[model samples]
Target chain A: MWTWQHVLTTVFGSIIFPLIIGLAWGKLVEDNKSFGGVLAGFFIVGTVWLLNHGIGLMYEPQMGGNLPGPWSDMALAAFWGLFVADLLEGKKIELEPILSGILGGVLGGLLLFAMV
Target chain B: MNFRRILMGMCTGAFAGFGVFTIWPSSLARWNWLGGWLAAGIIITTGWLVNHYAGGLPNKEGGAWVDMALSIWLSALLGGTVVLDPVNGLIRGAYGIFHGANLGGAFLTIILQLIGATIAGYFLYAARRSDA
Candidate 1:
């Protein structure tokens, strides 16, 4: 029963707000000029929330249901926040970090689906 | 990509995933915006622990994030497919106890996490390819 309005709100609250905060943090704390933090925050939080919302919709109750709550969202935001800050701090991207993130995400998904 | 790092990444990811699963509330009625905050705490703590214990890797290029993001996205698709498709009956059956969620719905909820872990295994191969 969610219309475009609900979707838009979710996007704004879940994605845009985090992105703005990330951008600000990058600028103020990390002095990052490239806005890499914004992108990272957007990608990680956006993907996780969007996917969680989509899955929750498949069930009977669409609103909360099995979707992730603020706990997970804030966790993701903080992770990206530090990640972007580090990137701004001149931390080089390597296969290890990417692999680590991917592996962690997938495992989290599997555990969530199978157990929680 | 070093093989040792890949192994460590898998272990780290699994540990994080386990932590999320443990802290996440079982009932939908208990779920709210606060759950996101809780999940976030678990992820950050676990991630920090893994990085600290496993030995962080060297930095490469910004493109790595692009590749990682793309891979994570694609892996969600893949995980969704695996969960929803009828061919994965065993997995579906195993996961059926969680709120009686249909395959499609279940796929949506957990796709990102699965993709995150799945893509880590292929980082080495993906790194070698020019297109990646």
Candidate 2:
């Protein structure tokens, strides 16, 4: 049911790549602890990617992973970023946002099924 | 911060979580685990939040439904863990680990959800102790 391409893409493309981007973004958020864009992080990751590519509009994310054409899910990476932020800040794991994100994800997924 | 509150919360929520998924209408075609868990999560989490805010919430008054909130919170946590399965969100990281919505999978989901909620509770308390 899965090819080598699928295996490789799912592992590296889906998991590892997002993990790396998440770590970087997490570190950035940790530095700016007062920053309020965690929700927006999940919201506007694509625009950040566009800017990170030296589209010449914004400072690169703490580190870069906006590779063109890679199979990436910005929301997943952002969730990991939130996890890392909590860990780095030594704060309570932000359960509310995570639950909310899951709610959004499942609701969005179901809506797609409905549309079809 | 009675420690038993968390434990009691987990035990009750565990059943609530199991019960919510157990009665899910997967046979209905339109209602699958994703929809089931999403509805459950939304209802549980929202109910918990409302309980908090409604009970003199901004200032932390007496008899504010802490245990009930904990149960609801853990129930939502359980729901969150459920939808990550391959059958639902197809969350790649959870693919092999979570399996799908089968018997063995449901058992595993309960256990993992317990662990997840427990860890969250640990963090919540640890932060509280430090704050105090």
Ten contiguous residues with the weakest lDDT in model 1 chain A: A54-63
Model 2 ranges off by over 4 Å: A1-83, A92-116, B23-132
Highest TM-score: which candidate?
A: 1
Q: Rate the local accuracy (lDDT) of all candidates.
A: 0.37, 0.31
lDDT of 2 by residue, B70-115 (tens): 3322332223322234356422111111222223322332333333
Q: Compared with the true structure, what per-residue lDDT tens digits does model 1 show for residues A5-102? A: 53434333333323443334334325643343334334443334434432332121212344322122223323343344344445565666667666
Per-candidate count of clashing residue pairs (backbone under 3 Å): 25, 0
In model 2, pairs of residues that clash are: none
| Least accurate 10 contiguous residues by lDDT in model 2 chain B | B92-101
- Candidate 1 residues B15-92, lDDT tens each? 544443343332111354444444434443444334432343322455333122222222222222112223333222
